[model samples]
Target chain A: MSTFYFIAFLSIFFSILVISAKNPVHSILYLILTFFTFTIHYILLNAQFLAIVNFIVYMGAILVLFLYTLMLINLNKESEPVKPFMVKIAGVFGGGILAVALASSLKLVAASNPVILKNPDLGLVKNLGKVLFNEFLLPFEVSSVLLLSAMVGAVLLATKDPKTA
Target chain B: MESLTNTIHAVPLNHYILLSAIIFSIGVVGVLIRRNAIVIFMSVELMLNAVNLLLTAFSVYRGDASGQVFVFFIMALAAAEVAVGLAIIVMIYRNTNSIDINVLNRLKW
Candidate 1:
């Protein structure tokens, strides 16, 4: 097998462990590994800018927040309860159906021809930065507004009850 | 025609598709099976990532930049999703000390 397949297998394996792990903290840590693998995949795909952003936003900021949240709710023991076996089986069935449907639809919907650019080395960051600033400017700014609103909303929710203080 | 076919067989699109399918299924399983809100959220991310993988594979097969652009948007959306999702999880945790999504049904009037 190729290195790509090896990395891909490792990514899938770690992500599965992430969801199945009982400890929330451990799950989050595993999720970091999952994100790292995604970054590798992005790099392989020549999306250099996205890989860096994944490292910074997901591994750096989001995982830190996950750890902080885990620390904040330090219960005496693990809090999430396990579901019954039947429910799990049902879940597997439901998820299976969805996956099959999605895959089939994509296959049926014939895609357009690939457009491999002659200059694949046009630095992703530079090109994306130009695109963001030029054509995608409005949407980019709107995203900032959306993020600020989410931040404010989170703070409001956190401080709603004085008793929790 | 035989020689052309032999040369074209080097890159298999099926491999990428199969891998994407597995990732998507894993995400779906996590969402359906787990009760923890965080894990479910992560599973959702997994599903999104799986879709992104499929998009990338298709883009490569077809030689399109648009698929990569779509992946870019998906990543932005995933970050936004995580921010909102984590906040909601925090709120749910404070209201009740458990992240078990099964109990979220009790929030109904």
Candidate 2:
């Protein structure tokens, strides 16, 4: 096994831990680790700009939000209620089928005439900036609008009182 | 072309597929087993990340910058999702004082 495989395996393992852990805080911590591993993967792919952005946005900002949300709830319930045995069995069966289907399809896709890129640049921050401002400018601006809407909607939902008003 | 060829050869396709598979499974298990809405949101993020990984891999293989562009969009959408999702979760918590999604049925008419 190569170093890439090792790192990839580690990333997946930690991510699974993130989901499986009962404690929400622990899950968030594991998610942070998962994000870091993804940053490493991005670096390996030579997407240095993306790696830094991943670190800053996901590990830095998003994970913090996740943690804060968990804290705010203050359930004082130590452990989340375990899912029933029947649900667990169904989950395993469904997940297994999905994985098998995806794996076989991916194998076929990978084997069929592998695409090879030509003249691939480093795609540094500068290059990405240029492309964002030039070719992808419209979509980028639209995304800003989307974010604005989400923010406003969130505030409205959180503030509304069904009982009093 | 030369640089792309080297990059493609550097990372094998199986690596991407395996990562995607594992991450997707995590998301599935999360949605099935976890009752907390916030954690379920995180699980969905996991699934989106898996798809992003595959997208970037294909972009690299095909030597087109578009896939990365899509990843950028996905990230933006994810941030928006979290902002709105957390707010909704807060509302749900406020209403019932519980984040357990299974309990959500009582809120519905």
Candidate 3:
């Protein structure tokens, strides 16, 4: 129980660093730490499959890709755009108000029935695979299409076009 | 495992909701305050993750695997989004030599 609190604090703290870091490389490294904490949270929840996937996909693939791009562009500190101070304050105020509103409204609702983990093994890969293939077959297939489209779009967008340039 | 249910019982569901809510709000503030395009993309990922965490919590609480399955799809979606989004950012950089959102406002070089 206390482990959860400590990990949650680490997650929040690292994510804060992700956005607050001055250098993009430092931000990416912090983001990796943030995702690592999330992986731990998944383990704490007994979602074994999700934890591994999050570790591989998020920390391994996605964030590494981010780091790669940050290197490719080599955005120097001078190149980093700095918004006005007033805009930043407005952003924080707006986000705080949003959080307050959501918290207050959620508090108004009757307390939800306590959670009970009925199936301890429900988060295992086997059960999740069964549920995925059996009930969510179409969506699963559609997601492949989505991936393919995204791939093609990314390639097309990334390739240099002699005609346009 | 008895430990599974025990851990879920350890942390109340409300705490999960509030934690995710705060994370999501931080994502929002990141989007609003940051001028860099890539940071904005990272912020969006943060928001998606908060939702994924909440979904997993609900799935565990209800003993339902479907929510986890749905999270897998969201992960896929996020991957695809990052691919396309970073590609767009790269292109923006190639042409404008800058990946700042404010620079793209005019929509014309």
TM-score of structure candidate 3: 0.95
Candidates ranked by TM-score, best first? 3, 2, 1
**Chain A alone, model 3, TM-score?**
0.93
Candidate 3, residue A13: lDDT: 91
Q: Model 1, A1-165: lDDT tens per residue? A: 255677788988998798788887888889889889888766665666777877887789877877877787664486568899999989888877876876776677555333232346332777667656777678777877877887777777666577657
Q: Is the docking of candidate 2 incorrect, acceptable, medium or high quality?
A: medium
The lDDT of each candidate is 0.72, 0.77, 0.89
**Which is superior by lDDT, 2 or 3?**
3
TM-score each candidate.
Answer: 0.83, 0.89, 0.95
**Which model, 1 or 2, shows the larger lDDT?**
2
The number of clashing residue pairs in each candidate reads: 6, 2, 0
Query: Which structure among the candidates has the greatest TM-score?
Result: 3
Just chain B of model 2: what TM-score? 0.86
lDDT of 2 by residue, B1-109 (tens): 3442454455567767767887898788888777778888888988887887777777666766777777888888888889889988988888777888888786588
Per-model B-chain TM-score: 0.86, 0.86, 0.92
Candidate 2's displacement at residue B58, Å, is 1.3
